[model samples]
Target: MAANDFYKTPSDAVTAVNSIYFLLNAGSNAVQTPYNTLFNTGMNFMGDDENPGPGATNPDVRSQSVLGHASTGLRVLQIWQQHYSGIKKANIAIEKIPGIDFGANTKLRERLIGEAKFLRALYYFNLVRLYGGVPLILKDLSTLEEAHSKPRRNTVQEVYAQIEKDLIEASTVLDPIAGGADAGRATAGAAKALLAKVYLTQRKWENAILKANEVITGPYGYNLVQNYAEVFLPIYKNGPEHIFSAQFKSVSQGQGNNQAPRSVLTGVPGIVGSYADQVVFYSVPDATKPGGVDKFFSVYKLYSKKDKRRDVTFVTKFKSPTNGNWYGRLNDPAIPGDSVPFFNKYWDPANVSNLAESGANVPIIRFSEVLLILAEAENELNGPTGIAYTNINKVRRRAGLDDLTEGLSQHQFRDSLYLERRLEFVFEYQRWFDLIRERDAAGNGILESSLHKVGKTNASAKHYLFPIPQQEIDLNPNLEQNPGWL
Candidate 1:
């Protein structure tokens, strides 16, 4: 622990662990900084799917996204620092809680430790996936001397091993779910689901399948909500589909943040009657907006007319009161040719708060993802078996799509599974990581053909791993940069 007297009782231990979840949503400065939104902005823009929205004031974010590479950019640096800050908090709780004995029943103490370990693993998981192997700091630096002794980066494999160990231990000690005030805390099911994803990222198909099955069959009471659109509604948050989400409250800007800037329709500068504040978070757009600077690619063109998810996923049509005309993201008589679509997934019409402060929980993992994992892992193990087909069909049926073709080869199933994930998780900050993990058959480059298809020609072998932030390198002379950045 950072201080020996920091955690003396079980309540103190629980409070410290709870603080980690708060850091995930609200930043150190609270109102001005929403850590999760900023982190997702960096991830979403870096990918090929989203573009910088019109009138975007953040030059650092815009340059990093459109140019496809910026080692020392502001958002990149902030993301690195925020993640490490989270890791530091998690480390403190993990190190201190286990040693303190709480009278008779040790279950409370042990569960708190499990929660800390789960959060620590999650912080490390994000670090490994983004910057590859980062410094694996598991304990708190209690003094300035300990902190000044800079640590070197560990191997990617070593980081994964640590993450795996933490999650495995967490699953055993944590409860399946929490109620009342502790509703959003980590659960045994969350640990299993995350561990399953870790295995999937490592391409350990059998292990991924095993962990996913435990999550699916476990008595956590998770299920796919009937309506795809309703699943993201603030009322339905942490409901049936939710395995894990970063909880937010709409009381104040300092208290909570949302995905509005990246998902809303923004344009029309300085208009008094503008509906901007009603729909979006900030006046300045961060990523994509409908009918403005950077807009979404036409996923509507790819989706069937019968597909329900298309409407839920992206905004295609809306009424524009400014011009007293109707507008459509793709093609409509009232809108101009340049207008493109924006994400509608995070829209909360009921949220009439100032600056569109939303209470909507940001989903990290859902039951649908578990089903997809089961399908993908099963198909990889054996070419489109009955189990794989059945699970994939469940997702498709909800989206108003037909069942997948029955006789796909192993390679074909892999491609189909990737496409499914793309459509399912659009605008949720999953695309970049998905592309990073995907490898070509020749193993020459990551997302080579996929990036090219999306006109992300700036993407190259060097992009397989993000450069270790320059600020971190400067602070710690021992830290080495990722290969291409060197």
Candidate 2:
């Protein structure tokens, strides 16, 4: 039957073809979620508490604080396994392309290969950064025998080199912009951007800036959104300025919906009375969680007032459907307090789905982030100057703000750029990167006493990269562990 042929012929298996790429992106209920530092701003669970995400929702995957629970072990393993699975799928697609093919449409074939390579490189990049040098498994494992023996940790240099190779290959094969039904596919610009990041991590300053400039100036269909808010509008998903984003389309709640929805779903009209701390906040939180204890709304308002992205990225009481006036955090959780503020930024209230089922595709990588990267990388490479300031100001200009012509000293420039990144990209997983990048050649990233109030973290070599999972170390004698692990 025709249906049987579709399943048997690799060329006809379009669903299988797409599934190969989705493995890297499919959201899982992993433990030690970014909710602690990234998703959450109010909660103070860091160096002291080892366990991170004890599911405020699920009991099974909950670990007290990510201290040393076994389930957390599984969750961490899941992160590795799932991403590797995606990488495997990509490698398989690359290998099988020549043999069992996707018709004679040469362009489609090249695009598919480009996208697969992009995903493969990304998966490896994520792994290598987390575990230092991991085994570079490029070939598709067919037999169980090959699978068991082939998995070996590669050297850090080797892994970085592989990432570079794959990204370059993808760049050559991909189009600048995916169009029509192919918009979600990886593009040449995306490949180039990821390569820029890879270069930045390796401290190859000139190359990082050059590659970033290429994307900024090149014709891959990216330009800054006129309004900071427009950048994240779900109505115009994958807006003009987005270089690459995790695309989510809901066919009544299918793939792409993520924890992105929690900002609103979890903020439903209710008293934050868990602790008698009824800070019914109607605004975005700063260093302190606006609604939770040890929370402060003053910093949020003060910092955000001048930040252009403040209004667009948040649904402050000032922009709410009601009086549109700023309401600070409510101090009492018992009464659904008089002046309650909630974050409506990461949610579409129209979404009637359950808390975990929201479909606001998280913006993991975007043109705005690259702009900041170039600004910082250029500052590092060229020191404080008008040239680097131009890039930095472009970011600020969008947030309804002015350029930093005044803070021209090298130290001041560095401090200003890093703080701008922190304030602009709040809860977007950039804070950790900021701390990492602050390290000098000697590896010191100390927060001056002034900034310690946010989360004072002193960086050492042990933290440059996370420790290799002990399980993997025990199972594979070849895998050496990172420093500072038991």
Candidate 3:
């Protein structure tokens, strides 16, 4: 059916909304594209906090760790294509759903539009963050002529303005709660939380603080789960702590979610005994799982012994099923196996039978992040107040750590907040983006120094924004490349 036909009925509208999410989990679905893995790898593993696993040699995997991928590479190109494809799908829904009259269920029209707007904002958010100032395509193209003659790239400010507007509108129309099969769908809290991050990135502290407070204390009643590990368990996929996630259900390869491969470590020799049998390959699965190949840093090491979140975040060692021998001894290169602990946040034993496609939901945002945003915004707006300490300590106490020290200077508190977010959000694709986000008094990134400290020397000012994919510029001459990339 045509795009307009899909929005004429409420059932079609739901399907249209669900179609936007497919691009997020799109793997090798006959389109010959790979996106979810590439985006996650570039954003999460390409930084100082995570790197190639010991003995990893895949050029694509190593290139991210070393910051050497070209715009023409499949990794960069696919991310560009997928986001725009999703944007196109969202635009169609947004254009058609608004005018349709849903009879007695008029509220459904508003909710579907809100969902489309939220998703479109998310696509634009990813685009702007990775490749600063992408083309802002909001309306559905009626003809190939218009599609071919696209507009020039929008300014980063213009893009953020649209994102903020969409999210603000979405927040007003979306219901505060969604459950059952709709559990993973967007809500008012999701829109507000994402808008708060956008505000935070732009250094709009008061606006960020306001939106974050709404998510924290709004009608959603979101609160951190007492146990950190419970956050990722399949049973807790849409738990109170989860604000939004790209939903995944384990099934066949072509039928399964693509990101599943990015979380499993089946082929690593000693790490997973007889690696071949440990995972089943159906469609094209990447050679490595991004999280598995990620080596930990002091941010993970600094966790106090009393901190309960440590065990859930990573595994220091594991016993091989073949020889019953334990592997993963940290800092001891003399050992026979890989010592670096694998990220455990997405581990699922059930995936063993379902091939490498895990059922774990990739977290887009969680309540814990909301708490940290609140803390950081409060501190930035008004130096270390009781509210700031309480917000941050809520996360600390959950991890079994004591409350943050009182009377810290604004600079000290800022550093403290950064550290907490790093430790709490490891491997969820925030590190690299955090490093390059906002500039300081000297016009340098706030977290760029941290990247240098971990030997990401290639992460210079040019890398603050990734190059616009060459393929995109070739197709639309109006799209200009970022500076230093030309």
lDDT scores of the candidates, listed in order? 0.74, 0.59, 0.73
Better of 2 and 3 by TM-score: 3
The global Cα lDDT (0 to 1) of model 3 is: 0.73
Best by lDDT: 1
User: lDDT: which is higher, 1 or 3?
Assistant: 1
Candidate 3 accuracy as TM-score: 0.88
Tens-place lDDT per residue, model 2, 258-348, is: 4444343122333111111111122333344444443333224435567766555544332233344333444456434323333333454
Where is model 2 more than 4 Å wrong at Cα? 1-17, 28-72, 265-302, 315-345, 352-357, 440-443, 446-461
Per residue, candidate 1 scores C-alpha lDDT tens digits across 1-486 of: 434777887778878888887767774222223234675456666665666655344677666665445678777777777777778888888888778879887989888889888988988888899899889998888688998989999999999999999999999999998767877889999999999999999989999999999999998998988899877787777887888888877666445445553455544221111121111111223244454523324444456778888778766445444565554444333434534455766665555223246677778888999999999888877768999988888998999899999888877777788888888887666878888886554544456566665666677777777788898889998899988795
Off by over 4 Å in 1: 27-35, 267-297, 317-339, 353-355, 441-446
C-alpha TM-score for every candidate: 0.88, 0.78, 0.88
Clashes of each: 1, 22, 0
Determine the C-alpha RMSD for candidate 3 after optimal superposition of all C-alphas.
6.5
